[model samples]
Target chain A: MKPPKTDSSDFILSVQNLNAWYHTTQVLQEISFDIQRHKVTALIGPSGCGKSTLIRCFNRMNDFIATFKLAGQILLEGQDLYDPAIDPVEVRLRVGMVFQKQNPFPKSIYENVAYGPRISGIRRRHQLDAIVEESLKRAALWDEVKDKLKANAYTLSGGQQQRLCIARTLAVEPEVLLLDEPCSALDPIATAKIEELILKLKDDYTVVIVTHNMQQAARVSDFTAFFYLGELVEFWATDKIFTVPKDPQTEAYITGKFG
Target chain B: MNSTRQIKMRLIRQKWGDQVFQTIAVIGVLIALTTLAALLIDALSDGLPRIDWKFLTSFPSRKPAKAGIFSALVGSLYLITLTALIAVPVGVAAAIYLEEYTSQNSRINRIIEVNIANLAGVPSIIYGLLGLEVFVRAMRLERSLLAGALTLALLILPIIIISAREAIRTVPNSIREAAYALGATRWQTIQDHVLPMAFPGILTGIILSVSRAIGETAPLIAIGALTYVAFLPDGLRSPFTALPIQIYNWVSRPQKGFHTNAAAGIVILLALTLLLNALAIFLRNHYQKKHS
Candidate 1:
């Protein structure tokens, strides 16, 4: 599908002056950005630059930490997620996350895919079977795994495990998908397969990906946001960020002068 | 040339030292095994003929051939049932709360952690005295089976908590994060993911603690359990006698026959503990295979 033309009206997630702290140390400093609906946005930065921390904030995953503190607002479809009335659990269901490491549960492959819908209170056997098959098909893993749905998930190779994780995320039919370097642990062939799936996913889901590989961001995303030391250095169209970045730091990073 | 000679000498010395350490370790194992073997042989020779249905069925008596351990067997069973019921749930719940729910870096959580570690090393007899004061006196449980069970429960509670925490900790942080990412609550994540992976380890701990409780004699003696209970305890509050007390009484008597009876009782106790340990090991292996 072609990239949606630039439009602020299509922004599905908006962060405004978001500041985050882990204990006494501040991590994300006054970060503000927008995630357009049905578009792939790639967050690119060196290690410890707060890209993962920023994306985790979208789902409030950092609330699990006692020392974690954040100020400012994260608005998902114009709703303030940090509002006391909004349950973090509810926020997570609507905005699913896939971790860097392939972490399939220690259960059968079918059960792993069905985990999200099961916890959301769907209990019928036949309905779960249909959801599991459809999700695996969308993830491009159905043909290889259709016969062995009863087998354990770890029996699959690393690449298959990563795709299985994506299928698990999609089974819940989330409005947005947050990926934290989802391909960092996989081989090249697995990486290509996942990129294809993520590109296909852009037609239906808002995708926010944090990646260290510059070429991957360029290949898959429509918008690119560069961060440095807890601050947003630049955010623009992927083409402009690659060719003529507005910030010198972004230019140096893209040109490989320094991290 | 001189430096090469020195290096050769140093290598030879290191090899010699390793052999010496290995010899010491083997000697230590042999010494322990020899003592254990002696005890087993003596118990078997004296007790094997006495292990019969009649020997198991009759109550204690003045006549040596007629006496049995019926009441003591029944009392021990009741005590363990009560102990398992009280200790397993409380110990496991405390473990879950500490491992999954609380932050390890927080001051209060750290303090609780250190205290639980210290409690595990505290002498079992100390727990007995505490149980005597708390359950038997303050709670007015008397010298009944309930008091004995509660005392043993306190004795093993620290063990259960420590093992359960270790088991829970073995589960990777990634699994928990995945569950939470799917919108599962903290309780749901623990019950579904953490507990299943940790069940085998927790069962191992419970087996070990219960076996230790069964062999314990001092705490029961300190709590004033009788040595010659003629009948089974009627209920929770009724007075009781256990296997250890009965054996102690028989061994202390002047009659040679009671000593034989004591050996026979020791054999029964050994069989009971082994049966329990085997059952627990079977369960742990079954779960580990299923998960791994």
Candidate 2:
């Protein structure tokens, strides 16, 4: 592991010259970005614009697909993640992901939250209990779910399930959290709560979110990246990206000219 | 035509077709049930009186009029155990590999899959021939219990594999992703999440396949399983006769008593199959309720 540079502003992750493909079809092209520590960065784009693909690349989740391939250098705290010596499993632990759909395991609520910690070798009941409680609290779900920790996670509402998934990711104490359209499947109220949770989560974890809701990107993210046709069209402070984007495509998308 | 008249005509036509199809389907179901009921009634009427403990426990005698199915019953049990031991692991493992590890597009995997499907449809006697050549004569095991079990194992292996693959395939992809996201390795995900979720279905399939294996006579007969064994098989190496083989022998005999014994054996076989099927249903329902 490379030590953080003292002279530099802390960037938890940096992507350089990233290109990804599914078989012969290129899905991402030469994408580059920096994720600052303890801040929320939103990737905003239309569907099929590679937002999900970009987020999946952070933890190497694309490896599960048979045709998935990538050429890139992803640096985590100045360490090259794609190095042969670096395990994708270790990378995933450090960079946790919440999916678009609320997929809590069919297990109990406590088991769902404790799954990551358990797999990472935490076995004692008290230790697991603490991790589960702390993670649920961090995700703002503990109070709602505390009494029924033994209940099946699937019994929860969509919003609660999504939060449980978030808690599950948080239990492993990841440094960076990647969420790919986490609010898409949620109701408006659930979306609002999750957006608030995302904003709050940035105080402790570097959070990267992909959202189709432009107002959401403007409301929550400190910085925003706009993508089009698998390329990074523009990246700037959230206020600037919404108000005065340098790229015409970004302006057009935000103004609802075309997605 | 007026719009109302046109709409009425269309509705009548649709209703007529629906009624015709529904009636056809109902008739088909009734026919199947009637056949099953008739067969059960005939078997019971012929076999019920001869189902005394003596008939169930005694061995076949020199007189065709006094034969019993004890040796056959014990032989079937031994054959089932050996077949289960050999077939279950191999079949389920093949299913897991095909469903979880192999890509659908690979030529070699496709070839293997196609061959398995084809093998499932092949006559049971062909498997007996293979077993005869491979496990019995070539390996010099003779017409022993082991040979019969191996033949039955091969006869049922394809069905078990097909059913197990279906079971494993029914597990949601989301569950797999959830495990993977938790930093669980492929093998860990399969062992911890996938297998547990698929187990009830796999068990149901295995039980059904085993029931079919239990009633199989052609493969055993082809493998030269003795029909009139006077003693129970002591080991896999010993000569054996299964329920179907003994039933076949009794039914073939000219005496009325042996024919009655065959019917009694059929009743026992049917009862055992029904028990296994009930267990499968119970397991499936239990798992479904838990998961749901």
Q: Highest lDDT among the candidates is held by which one?
A: 1
Q: Which residue pairs collide in model 1, if any?
A: none
Q: Supply fnat for every model shown.
A: 0.76, 0.51
Cα lDDT tens digits, model 2, B73-129, are 888888998999999999999999988899867888889999999999999989989
Tens digit of per-residue lDDT, candidate 1, span A116-214: 999999999999999999999999999999999999999999999989999999998899999999999989999999999999999989999999899
- For candidate 2, what is the lDDT? 0.89
| Candidate models: Cα lDDT each | 0.91, 0.89
Looking at model 2, give its docking quality level.
Answer: medium
Model 1: per-residue lDDT, tens digit, B38-124? 888899899978889988878889888888999888888888888989999999999999998888788998999899889889887
TM-score to native of every candidate shown:
0.96, 0.96
